[model samples]
Target: MNIRKVLTAVLPVALLCLAATARAATIGVILPESYPSADQAKELQLGMTLALKTWPGDAAPKLVIKDSGCDARKADAISQEFIKAKVDVVLGNWCEINAGADALRAAGIPFISSNAERVKAQDLQLQMGRIELNAGEKIAADLRRQTGLRISARTSCWMDFDAALSERVDAVLCPVLTMDRGRWDQVANTYGAAFRKPFTASSARGYAAMEVALNYLRRAKAMKPAAALKETQATATLLGPVPAADAPAPTTALQLVFAPHLPKLNAQQTQTLDKLVKTKGCACPGGTLRNGCPRDSGPWGELPFVVRGGGTPAACAKAINILEL
Candidate 1:
């Protein structure tokens, strides 16, 4: 073969191969820069980074990160940018995803979120599907049934732990996400070592979102991306699975109970206290003090704070007045 003829053929083939090798999926990430705190955003990014390191593919997806600033307009703008860039998928926290839902859907790009608010009628109108780990409404409904109380689901992205401590809320219901304690511990240890901080629920959610995105890409090879995600079964993750629409709601919830410190009582005093609690009746919405007073439901001063003098109804009545004073 002539030198020029052979060289031309080899170079074109090599270039094609190189181009194929360089081509990788693009994943757009929208994270808050300041709204929830810079530390939280960093934690989420670190979790995604950890997942990328464990990617089974020869070539990992390219990450295009944008600061959403937890603003709806900013998130929408970022979504438009991702659409222009032709990203295969988008991963975001609670603050940014809902704001960008329409744009991402129009672009035919899948979106995965770590948290979600109670689904509304408007949310149902969106064509693109969302894979959310924290389903607040479902969790709240389950808690209501279990506790026989009015449980309100959080509608905002801000932290609610402080609200739980306030006088206005009776109790805060938290869901236990980790299905495998052993696996969670392993991941948490690795995350701690890398970030120099304890692994948080947000971090776990971020890692799980990436895992789900990768799973979607794998399934997309055989089917459309939307269909693949829709057909995605319960994937074992640090936070259990991406709940199927028809899946049963979680039966358990962790309720953070708040109550005033009670005086230590002896065996006789304890027996007397129980009797008094049942007879006196708790002023809270839950009906009785057997489960402790939910101060949010009624005045704390109405609670029988002193059972010291005697377990009689009159003694409890007098104690209540003293507490009020």
Candidate 2:
């Protein structure tokens, strides 16, 4: 071959090699706790992995997953590692990432999250794309409408909101936490309490959202300001009933749902309770004697539930919308 021609071919090959090396992508994943009920963070990992499996390239992006403990401190640590590793993309789960979400944004990295807990709206990394589960709220709403159950200010703590449940359920669908004592629920249902285990989950869309985030990164091609904006928009608009939708700005924050174990008093129970109310002068001031007034031991072995709004089966389905960010 001519000397000039050989040099030209060699330069092209060298440039191609450099380009290939530079294009290698890196993906990091962060998850919250994984115990009973829904582990959205784990679901995110599974979704991302499934998508990575289908990627058609000899140099697939590095996939790294870390736990966030559903705690702000833990999320900060995981985010720090991701920063040091210089990951091209990240997807975090639950509310844990809220703490480090700002740092990531300052670093100009993009991330997708599945928790609706209130967080700084200005941060760019904190993209509220995937919802964890809106079905819980919907179920609560539907239950209220259909059952016409009289709700109490207190909600079931079996799915405690402060720790395990969300704090947005409305009247007749109060928030519950796991911290509630077992005796409480037992006491609540000594009679025909007709209690329903408030339902929540890692949910069906858990994995799919992660896949969406990964696919978004692959398609973005560049991480410039404009491209990041586009990705942010895409992530902000994720659709589904599970994980719920992000609360729109200026929109009232979703209200909490609280209902009694015996939300709807059986008709016979109501009539019996009502007679007791009238005979015992339930409306009377101070304590009245059981024989002549309202008493715990009634015709049936039932005690009036100690709660706000006592036993009025007023429908409360029409409550503020709860959008899970």
Candidate 3:
């Protein structure tokens, strides 16, 4: 071969090798440190680390974490910082994502979160949470069957329950994590041991978000900054595939869905229902309600629920019982 020709071929091959070897990308993570989600932030970091370890690759994404404090002002400021740094992709805001979402989108950076309710899904805003298809009707049916059923909407632990009920008339829906209590406890215990705090709903979600982000980067080939800004409408994650679409947010406030008539509940049963509401949440095999409410007895017998606005709690409970039937 001529010397000039040989040089051309060798140079191209060497450049290709160099590009392949230096394929690392940067990922920015913003967590609410000032407020309660500090622990969740730590757990999120842990989850990302675990995902990276599990998914072997030479071109690992570098995580650049920043604190998007609980306040909107702080979140906005942190977002500005991420923009200045020109991070490839952004993940964060365990709290009000509105603080940072607008700025990030304007800058064309991808922002992913487990807390879907905070920000409406938009151009570059992505949520890692899932939606329930038909929760309200089902709940009403169950309540009706068990007349005199004492039920209360306990939303303290359920994340997306209110959102689910939106499809129903005169009410919002909430979700109860019916996943296997045993497995969840085991996982929470492990996380607590590692992080020195009990694992929480936020933590599990943070972990799931990281896994989802990793999945997107891997599938989308966002190893370069330009590629990172390439917004994805939907991506598969550890929890499930999520799309950048408007999702329901969690609401502690409730709306009563009135039935034609109320199911009669004796005072004693009403008291039992009150007790169930005192501790809101559902206990099932898997942290999910794929099947109906797990059959049980006493305070736990019927599924725990909540009603709001219009009608008394006792009245609403009776109405729900009538609806369930």
Candidate 4:
């Protein structure tokens, strides 16, 4: 499918009118193969439904969900089918989804982008001139507020992967993104999301599957691609860090990281940290390491086999610092 074609297919026209006499609009939603995760998908679906419930007007947009399977080729075919079906709009739900939306656009249809990854944003806006996001920018701002910290390109599920934590020790804070694998699943289940009216989360915020299609379709009613993009940028709002209360806080938790290539520590401070490491695994104070300790040895090691899954560190939930060892 070409760009213009799919966009027009996906974005519903106002044909489903403000009149009760008119029919509803068809909004086709394309998503990642395993997107939003299983639980996340359901919650997102619920969130979209909730938004539609309060949408201002006499008509509601109908949702048709399908898994794109992360295949670019498949996405192209899907986009074409939606266009053939005369869909009002089609929204691509993952950051790396193919350029079929451009095909839809070229075909004179409006496409809604649901990608939130940095690479995706850069490629979309730079290449297609059709781009939107959810939390990518806000996360950057949040990262800037953090001083003396840098992120690891390494994608391991390390405890300190979030660039936000290097600023402090003792009492630590973590981003839920770290909970994607391992025992993190149970931990992440606690949080949820909701949106305000005008429903920026679906449209102006991150690219909402439905809103992207709708907004573009509505605007296409008047402007060209360049004008539509200008309008989108002018209007999009920050999506995540939702309401502080809506998303769950990282549970009272602590993790350790080595203070790499640092100045030598004083005797007394070093001694105190070393003491904690010996007695309490490695929860040393002031983010320093405990003296004479081996790596990856936490209090949970006492188990005959294992305990505190994922190799719990030696420090208490409220850790003091990394071990000098």
Best by lDDT: 1
Predicted candidate 2 versus true structure: per-residue lDDT over 184-285, tens digit per residue: 333234311322321122322333345555556655566573375455454321232222224432111222333222334556544543443333222222
Model 3, span 1-325: residue lDDT tens: 6999999889999999989757676778777665554555566667666556556565678877777665668778888998998776778755554567778889977777655333444666666543323344355444444435323333322332223332223233344332345555665666666657766555556656666666557655635433443344455444444644654423222232333434456766455444333222222322233223323333333233434322333344444453233
Clashes of each: 0, 26, 29, 39
- Candidate 3 has an lDDT of 0.53
Q: Estimate each model's TM-score.
A: 0.63, 0.50, 0.54, 0.43
Tens digits of lDDT, candidate 1, 1-325:
6999999889999999989756888889888867777877777788888888877875788888999888889988988999998888888644644778777777788877554432332221211123223554554465344433344545222331222433444333343343467878999998888778888766776787788877777776678876777755456666666655533333222222222333344565444334433243332323444344423332212321212233444444344332222
Error of 3 at 60 (Å): 2.0
**Rank list by lDDT:** 1, 3, 2, 4
Superposing all C-alpha atoms, what RMSD in Å does each candidate have to the true structure?
10.2, 15.4, 10.7, 15.1
TM value for model 2: 0.50
Deviation in Å, model 3, residue 98 alpha carbon: 2.2
Best TM-score among the predictions, by candidate number: 1
Model 1 spans > 4 angstroms off = 1-14, 118-164, 167-170, 173-176, 231-233, 246-248, 253-325
C-alpha lDDT of residue 223 in model 1: 89
Task: Go through the candidates in order and give each one's C-alpha lDDT.
Answer: 0.57, 0.44, 0.53, 0.40
Q: For candidate 4, lDDT tens digit of each residue in 105-209?
A: 655555655442222432112121122222323332332233222322122211112323343322222222211143222212322324322321222222333
